[model samples]
Target: MTIDHFFQAAKIEGFQSPYDTIHLKIFYPARMPSQVEINREILPVDLEKAPFPVVIFFNGFNCDAQQYQWLAVKLAEHGLVVILFNWIAEVMPGIISLTPGIDVEKRKPTIYRTVPTASALPALLAKVEQLQSEGILAGMLDLQRIILGGHSAGGRVAIENADPDFFPQIAASFGYGLHTMATLSLGYEADTILPLPDSLPLLLMGGTCDGIIANSCDRYGISPGNATTPVIRTFQEAITGGRNDSYLLLLEGANHFSINQPDSTLKTPLLDFPATQPQESFRLLMGEIINLFIDTHVRHQPEASQSLEQLLNTPNPLIKSFERK
Candidate 1:
């Protein structure tokens, strides 16, 4: 609830106190049905600067825009413009029910219904472009340097939008297991998903202990029998065909819940996921890694690359890093 709780839950450390200048602005989609309008929140770094790199993040199933506030703030703190998007379908069942009877079991819930990755891209791109034209994003945002990332179901959205062919290739490369089960449950067929356009940079992050997704993939019978590498590899392969850069990182000892903000009382199960390091340590590690990843790739800061390399080589049994071919 509190900003401190958000940062702490995200495992952000080494700060004497919380930064107070993080600003938020919300944008409502222009033409979608009220039930389907997208909500975007912009968080700019507390410091003054011209044209920073921008990161537009999408949230996972049943999660609201705040789910990514911690990560977005972290990126903004490092001098990037961060935008968190809330998919209207994920939160509007009442409106969906009014349209026609919806099958909760057979059809994906409104929130889980497959959205064309392309459908949302233009709206998002236009928002940033508008900011540039109006001078709000002004010198601080480098229009050319943008990164897209997400978690759990949101991660699927990110990849699907970047390259629709991602899931099918994942299905084919990994075999019919957990990955397949997830694909089937989501109602995605190998033939229907599209490919990513040549313009966007992508980064895929997954936790070692991601129970829902990895477990689902495992139960369905995907390769590696667990959630770790197979999904990551699929994403790496999908983005390689585009001109944009791509990278996949596996946070060692981290579970799906750990990546989000912990509750104020810190009593949430998010604090208890099994990991080699204590929960806080792993969270901080993940935050730092994310910071470095955005800095190196989005901001074009060469020094950030060294930090990433050092973290990768560190003898942490829980972490793994890979670059797409």
Candidate 2:
């Protein structure tokens, strides 16, 4: 669904999940930034059909979950229940506006927060179960088809969580039949290479202009004049080392800020290249690519698989490179 359509759909009456104690803030993508505190809105879905897949998305470092609503909303429109959960700390409404004299550190995470990144998934899953038990998502969730996704620092969480070696203890704790079907990382990567098991899948999407994470000159190498990332190196290792379920997509002209909410205007040390395409177009492309990827790997939709194949084979202005092993 288009962004406008997503807003229209939100206006229609739908189930409003009760105060979610675990999910501090949730939003149904709107024309403006509007959040539903302690609750989540399940966009209009056909009740006669099977329940929708679940997507729990965490925001990048120093960014609010609402900044990624452009993505959460679109995913919901395309038949998934998207949950945008915030990290332990985020910018308040007041701080974002009183910015001219604000210290650089004040704009971002000022406190040293230490919630084990691995705990994010399990904590969220417990909250989801609580919501379901309370009839918020009763009979409307296909708990089997769950996907864990995140951006930047959040992406690191998803990547590390998917690896059996990183969080074996956490995985063992979730013996309640809940598992991450796949992991999608955007604008983030591990310091070392991490390859998923043959049964699980990985999709890594980042921008060529992402000066923050994509800053390594070569795989596992870094140079001062370069703006590449370790994600590329790790992704290459996954495919070459025989992880046949891995996939990677590089957005040509997109940047770290491009994936955030359109309303954001905070400045950063990262460079902002002149856009060759409209900003919203990039967000749409991101949503479309993510939707198709989830459908093919998580939902196992044949049509989505075909579409992904075409997008990879045929060159597009937006997609710099698409690869699957």
Count steric clashes of candidate 2.
Answer: 7
Candidate 2 per-residue lDDT, tens place, 221-273, comes to 34433333445655666335354446777777776666776444555424444
Residue ranges of candidate 2 with Cα displaced over 4 Å: 1-45, 90-116, 163-199, 214-221, 238-244, 262-265, 269-275
TM-score of each: 0.61, 0.67
lDDT of each: 0.46, 0.51
Model 2 — which ten-residue stretch has the worst lDDT?
171-180
Model 1 steric clash total? 19
How well does candidate 2 score on lDDT at residue 87? 38
Task: Pick out the ten consecutive residues of candidate 1 with the lowest summed lDDT.
Answer: 171-180
